[model samples]
Target: MDAPACAATAAQAASLQALLNTYLREMAPGSAVLADDRSTVEIPLSHIPARLRVRITYFSATGPHRFGPAQILFDGSSTWHSAPPVQVLTLIAQECFTRLNSRDAGQLPEFLRGLFNSNAGIEQNLIRHAGTPEPDGFLAAEQALTFGHWLHPTPKSRDGLTTWQQAAYAPEYAGEFRLTFFAADQSLVTLGSAHQAPADMLRQIPGLDGAFRLRPDEVMIPAHPLQAQMLRLDPQVQALLATGRLRDLGEAGCAFNATSSLRTLYAPGCRWMLKFSVPVRLTNSLRVTKHNELETGVLMARLLKHLDADGPRFRILNDPAYLTLTLPGRSESGFEVIFRENPFAGTDGTGIYNLAALTADPLPGRTALLTRLIQQLAADHGETPADTARLWFEAYLTCMLDPVLDLYDRHGIALEAHQQNSLLDLSTGLPSRGYYRDNQGYFIAQDALPRLNALEPSLTQQPALVYPRAHINERMAYYLVVNQIFAVIRRLGCDGLAPEPDLLLQLRRRLTTAASRLSGAGADFARYLLTAPALSAKANLLTRARNVDELETEAQEGLFLQMPNPIAAAQPQPVQERTDVLT
Candidate 1:
């Protein structure tokens, strides 16, 4: 048998870049030193008590940086030598454990395991699919994320799925398979629907009636095939199946494709997207649909209608219904399923791309999808790519940013509009419409309780929906500004379509204008973005080190650190008279 090769490939280099980027943004800001020209950077591994140096290929003000292989000098060493990504991970983990005062850093093993799995997944994806032209369609774009979150250490890691399962179930592999179904007795099932009955809606899936039969007294529950396998092993579930209280209908539906979030399955012919709770762990959380999340989905749908939340060019794909099985002694029976609105059905979904998929760093030797789209638009419009990018970006801000701020300003609703949850319609080769989706990402300001209560009296029932104004502001600053907008700027700059500083200037001007016209939380948040020297960003590395399940933690509890605000740097002038408003 041959020993596993240790050579650093593209996968390893990418992993290294992600880890270093997270460290610099959320952990090393005050401790690390950079050269005047930013040609090189020195990072201090305080726990290991070593100094690491690396050549900066690209220094992004928005935190996505490119660096050469690293070199480290130990406390007693007089020379610096090469260090691999795994070595860097170890030192960073040590630093986190020490700084966090962890008595038992048991999650380190799991973290390392995920890194290995992620590397293997990336290698396989590159070998099989890199440089291939992106497929056309909503589902194809969802599966285009071969290399996952660029800032995550284990972006492709899935703890519970075997290689065969991944081939059949993972979006990256473009797996399209039948959904696993079960018919549970009505007494043992819970169905919540805001508009249409969930079970009735499930029956409406094309060819679903032919696939399986449901008894008059039974309700159908659909799940990710992987989740079905795990549930069959659950002792409580096994008891129910053995007693004939629940009958496993097996994989019976028409082909369904896994979306970007692995557990969410989509079938274009179907009117709804089914989000399930899988046993597998993805990145920071175990992908389970919490009970509160199910209720929130139904509640939020009604609330949106009451608030008339849908803007002219922006809207949310609401989760209006859900179904799950009730198992004794368990709050969640591993059967929680959410029915999300599917606006992108068949031809209607064409040219609509999730913002993350559009901005994701492309495989080696290939241009980014966003860059390609902009270049094509430039050619069609007889203009330079830079000019097209500016125009496209302005449209994106109006369609996406303006609506989000308006929601917060008028209703105190702060959406978790991170890239993955954001979508854009580029049917004309530029963003024409923006969509935000996710039942679990809505955050309402507690200060607006009286106003919201009057709008939707049910608001008092969902106490978890409201959060402190400051908390919502912090999240908006990160999700809306740092994660979503900054990603767009980074994509344009790195792809050579436009300069990042130029985009940042554009963003600052837009926010300044918004502040002058907006009121309450929205104006305050916009002003903060325009003037604050530093912005809060989630610490993905530290979160992993602590093994925090992001879904389980409060919005304010997630690990966060301050980083230099790119918008502030682009326009250093103290809040001047508002003159950049766009009519």
Candidate 2:
């Protein structure tokens, strides 16, 4: 095959492999029959009417497995043949449709379309970026996630973006664009800040290209360029523009690059990173900020300041301010912008990376980024790759896992430190510190309400910020243990850095030791991880199939599923469950 055709074929295979991995782990966990030699796995599509089965090349205990073209068997047919991704996805969706309730079953067609769109996006990324030189620094890692979420079925599905727009806006495309500005009358705008005044931070955002200045009587709101286009079609915004209450200043800013999260923009030397509400569906939900979320972020920032000083070497990049329009009869004006403190500004962001970006799969025929980092560290220290990786994993636990557990134990606060929301400091060739950046993910346990009320009387009053203790425990299991830590194990195994079984043992020992030292829910959580036969995990495949908007879903929504715990499986002896279990 020629080079371009070969590249397209490879990209499709990669997309199919990712889809299959998610299907096996989340949808049909126990149904896959593995060969004794461990060379292939056969999965039966039991929910579908057709008597079909899929045979793949390889399988992994952790989810990142090698998969070749899948051989499929049709009903009452003795012959087997290779099937394309579209066919496989259709079969999977049909199976899901059969299994879901009538209401959810209606979402099948949209789900299938999203899968196709995601695959097309992946193909475009691979073919277009084939000859492009890799960029450097913090932005480099942010732009490095060519293949998006490992477990998400429609990881790169851009529902509202056109082909040209994605090229200009997507981080994978290494795109940079000017921010759209709007000057709204201060009376019609709502501004909140936990630290400096909101206007002061706006003034420091360099590069206003046109006649755009922050006025005392108005609020300057910066938005994603795509959002500006969508807002022009809104009747409320048009009425405000006609009445001279809001002036569209157009695009007036320095070129800001898209971060891993496409809605958040970053510019070098900028004091604050601007996160705006874009009118697009990135994965599961529309990328619009809620009014309650803004209040939650500012409250969390203030609460963080009052916490004890002797915490671990972990910091949460604070979202201390926000700017938005408060229109009558509207919950969101599509102009919500958050001012997040940018510590990785200028020359200081060299070795810091979003953990998701660090762990993302490389392009076809390229070495994974994490593998290269581990190899370089091993070579520098004159140590074996296995030894270096083991040390690296231990350091990660200290920096990332320890801090999260400590915070939950002491404050009953759980940050959604999932792979994408997490940051790792690799400046010293080892993880020395960890950071989390998310405004809408902080969860305060109801048990800690009294203590938090003493600190800030209205902290719990913030909308959707507090949850029952059991619910928080469930979220901790899914976000921290399953999504974040298990991903590390899978990467190590997939990249051939270290054995997953060895890493699982290492993780169990660390958690066991932690369970002995930690207090309250933290200790119980550790114990739960060690002893629970099944742990909660976000069922991304199923969530997509059911068309659930995760951000808009209530606490009782069915967004999670139980998966067999690898940690519990690694234990040599069966441990007794505690009466006061946190999960």
Candidate 3:
């Protein structure tokens, strides 16, 4: 009836099925979406939207292993004349679980990639990625789970109806795709193309190496022309191919490449800061940055178009990166697009008083330093409220836990919470608004799935995204709570006090108790901040990248506007301002 299920050699199919069962049960345990009847199931993915969407059906285990059909519609079609089954769908069930749940939702629990990526800091990233991972391939069954089936739990507004269908979560991939089967080392034209690239040198092709292939599952051609297959990469990803510029932002081993079309973007209400990659020149994933950055911004803007602080601000402007996107559009090969930008325009840790500043140099110690100033300024005016300082004091502070709650309430565990990827505006400082970014952090559903009963209806049910909680915690511990937050505080010591390392323990305690009923955001926890000794001497908050005495001299009254540190500031030279022009 169905194309003979498990088309691979019996050994290969069994081995893959077993590996998948092990991976999913362990990493994504209690995933209610798992059809409990068979080792695998088949539902054609071709009848759905062209975006990242899924339609699930199931037949779980009564066999050697349980399996189900998720039917991910990647550019839907009944039959896409593709490469051989081995080249495309052999052990299709296994890949469906591993790739969709692990790679897309970020990472899975104890997944070696996540383990190493999170625990290994920056020094041993490759070693981290190289290690064999857990066999959670059964997750593909969960991929078919839709919003009505699971939806994010927190941010309980009518907006909860939003799911990872189309606009955000598309079931497309790069390696071993369902599109045309390209030989890893197949001779690729490897043409060097970009906007403003020299026409004479446009087609000097190189070789495509390794068993590596660019299988863009979502790509389709009504009529195959120059190439037999087309790949529908993320729009932002297409821009990378089109522009070819992404920067190697420093990491332990440069985990992900990021380039920038604009040296800076000063979007006022944007949730995530947009940062583009360096102009790309390589044809491998190793060198190219991921596409979610653009999707991060665009998706936020479009989805939150109605909400207040929940969504992101977007600018589909023709930035320097636009040059690349434009050319790719002309090639008529661009699949989908994604985008991002820098958000630290005015914030240099100045313009307000925060806990990080509590221990840092010449500023006065742990008093409500900024608050006191506002009260003084207000009292001076015989005013009633001193709301001014409170607004400025909430630097880099995030939405109490909206994003994480949004995920956890729905999917269970959403990881990657930190100050750097977080966007907030103290420009008006009541700590009223901010944006969250970085999708490749963490997710966990294992424990929570059973606690809440996945099959039963609960207020927290969410459209399915691989719920990988343990993996999420690891990211929060490493990237956000520890690395980014603590690192920034250490850099900006309070008043005359030297930076202390234990500051994280203190901060962690605060974060842990943040949601407790007794506390309005765990206030009593970090109050040592209030008693911090005042500066041996001081200046306004805007005096960034400078000593207290120097900064004080530069402060324009206490109400500081973000400005570059004097002397070291490289005011953009008109000639240098255009950083995107190719030489």
What is the RMSD, in Å, between candidate 1 and the native fold over all Cα? 3.4
What stretches of model 1 exceed 4 Å from their correct place? 1-8, 46-50, 74-79, 84-107, 554-557, 572-583
lDDT of 3 by residue, 142-249 (tens): 111111100001001111112221112121100111111111111211211112221121111111122132343211111101111122234543444454232111
Among the numbered candidates, top lDDT falls to 1
In candidate 1, position 386 carries an lDDT of 79
Residue-level lDDT tens digits of model 1 in 188-304: 998788889886898878778867666788888888888999999999999999988899998776799899999998998998889999988888888888888899898889888
Off by over 4 Å in 2: 46-58, 101-106, 133-136, 209-216, 308-312, 556-558, 572-583
What do the candidate models score in CA lDDT, each in turn? 0.83, 0.79, 0.26
How well does model 3 score by local distance difference test?
0.26
Give the residue spans of candidate 3 off by over 4 A: 1-277, 280-415, 429-432, 439-467, 492-509, 515-583
Give the lDDT of residue 28 in candidate 2.
67
TM-scores of all predicted structures: 0.93, 0.93, 0.29
Candidate 2 backbone collisions, by pair: none
